[model samples]
Target: MKDILFVNSRFLSQEITGVQRFSIELSRSLKRILGEKVQFIAPKNIIHSHIAKELNIIEFGIFTGHLWEQIDLPIFLRKHNSPMLLNLGNTAPIFYKNKTSTLHDVAYEKFPDTFNWKFKTFYKFAIPHILKSSIHIFTVSKFSKKEIEELYKIDSNKINIVYNAINEIFKPIKIKNNQRYILGVSSLNNQKNFHSMIDAFNQIADKNIKLYLVGGINRNFASTKLLDEIDKNQNIILKGRVDDKELVELYSNATCFVYPSLYEGFGIPPLEAQACGCPVICSNAASLPEVCSDSVVYFDPYNVQDIKDKIELVLYNEELQNELRRKGFENIKRFSWEKSANKIIEIIEGLK
Candidate 1:
């Protein structure tokens, strides 16, 4: 651990979302286990200042954006002669040699319609090179490991499967049940399938149920063109990015939680919904099945009608809801950020 440094480009370069949360939570967990052996470095311009303040991050880099990651990071690593550069985010310096990087998913390539051309094109070129160059590749799920191996034609042995756990913050709270709404949280991207969810919500016979989209439209990326579509639907409310406390409230008292993502590396929200004691209704495609297992009611992501049917079934079925809630409690015990952090250190030490 003497010559190792954790790269914090993604932490500074972007806002605190699921991805940045990964960097923060994992860093905290790793710090507890490894003590001061773990250190961090990032750029100066950070969006999530409160979260960043918690970590002992050395903020010094010439540039900020993509150039900071690609050029500035690698130069710093070279100057320090770092033995291992742990890149917790999906992208890393393509030139860095002795480093491990985590690839959350390859959704952009598989679902090009979900992303703008700029976002897609940058990843298409950067990820493959980053994966190939890294000493070890870490992914969030078995589904993602297989996807990366199949797409990049890399040896499966090189990619480590580190599961993403529900943050401890998402506990069941004794909040007043004022709202009877179905909850969905994700960036307003095409692959999130929020539009189809709206269509599905409209089909449901239950006139009383309202659908809430929790995450905001990401202005950093090209607009998903969903604001108008969401605006048109009266029952649908866009809560766009809430604080952790508010999010837990939304999760705790909802009638149900819905995750209609078309694809994911590891579907953390379903596990989150489960942890918060909300019954999960999610897509049967990609990593959702692998992550949620028997705990969630599944629907075909491509079929709007299928999503509708599943949501309705979960809504009215008392026995099914109770059973899902039980199984969800049992299922969440399998993933731990502490365990994940330990495994990550083992991989780094093993490669060394």
Candidate 2:
């Protein structure tokens, strides 16, 4: 009999954002550690067939998306004697008491303007109940843990911090590129502070140094007024929704990677850039300072001039860039999928 059931509903319905990436990588590590003791379950409509096949996911339920998660998933678990459920994505079956959930951040609560009304309303109604019902909660950083505790009035001891690590594909590449460009990766949204980053990039004195923005727009988020500006600027390139290999190449070749996000559970892109031997210029906001530590050059996300200054500081200095790359390599050693997986196993065992 399976000891744990992984709610993989995110794989079926949602695209791979930071939240889904957390679930996917953690599940992979858990599967390696737990073997047949754990089983991954998802709805019948699987968007990530490659992932489903690798995980050997069992498809069930007539309903898809949240309907499948709320209705069919609980019913299915009930038939199986209600094994311990693991929900890595933000949401879970609200009524399932035997579950452990990973809530990445309280962005929806803190920055409600970033999301649509329906999305905000649903999470506000559902998340507290889910946290209360959960056996334990897992979040990505200390910043998030404190936020969750304060916002939901949950005990600090009940939450676990599982830091995100770069996938093997993100490692430093030996290839050389003559072209120079600054890189930014994340979904296009107000929370990302892309408007400020764009403005900052525009003010950069070097006309030849381009800025490449990688990622697609998330519809659930309220759109930022960046498209018209992007169209007007020739130096700013938007490479939307790249695959892992392409992302690694972009990171490896970038003169520097700039992340101007106002808030994060634990920023992953900076780590990915670091793993590819790229220097990082990051906003010292929210959980980013905790995740990045001293590895990245810090800037105020709200200040366009500060963002540009930091970018240029790293971009122009080869010695400083190399030092950051060295520190980044060292910083990355503190996190790994396997290590996080082992921690989860320990927690599960303690419960038993």
- Estimate the Cα RMSD of every predicted model relative to the unseen true structure: 1.9, 1.6
Tens digits of lDDT, candidate 1, 288-335: 888888888888888999999998888888898889889999999999
Compared to the true structure, candidate 2 yields what TM-score?
A: 0.96
Clash pairs for candidate 1: 216-240, 216-241
Q: Judging by TM-score against the true structure, name the best candidate.
A: 2
lDDT of all predictions, in order shown? 0.82, 0.88
Clashes, model 2: 0
Task: Please name the candidate that would achieve the greatest lDDT relative to the true structure.
Answer: 2
Which residue pairs collide, candidate 2? none
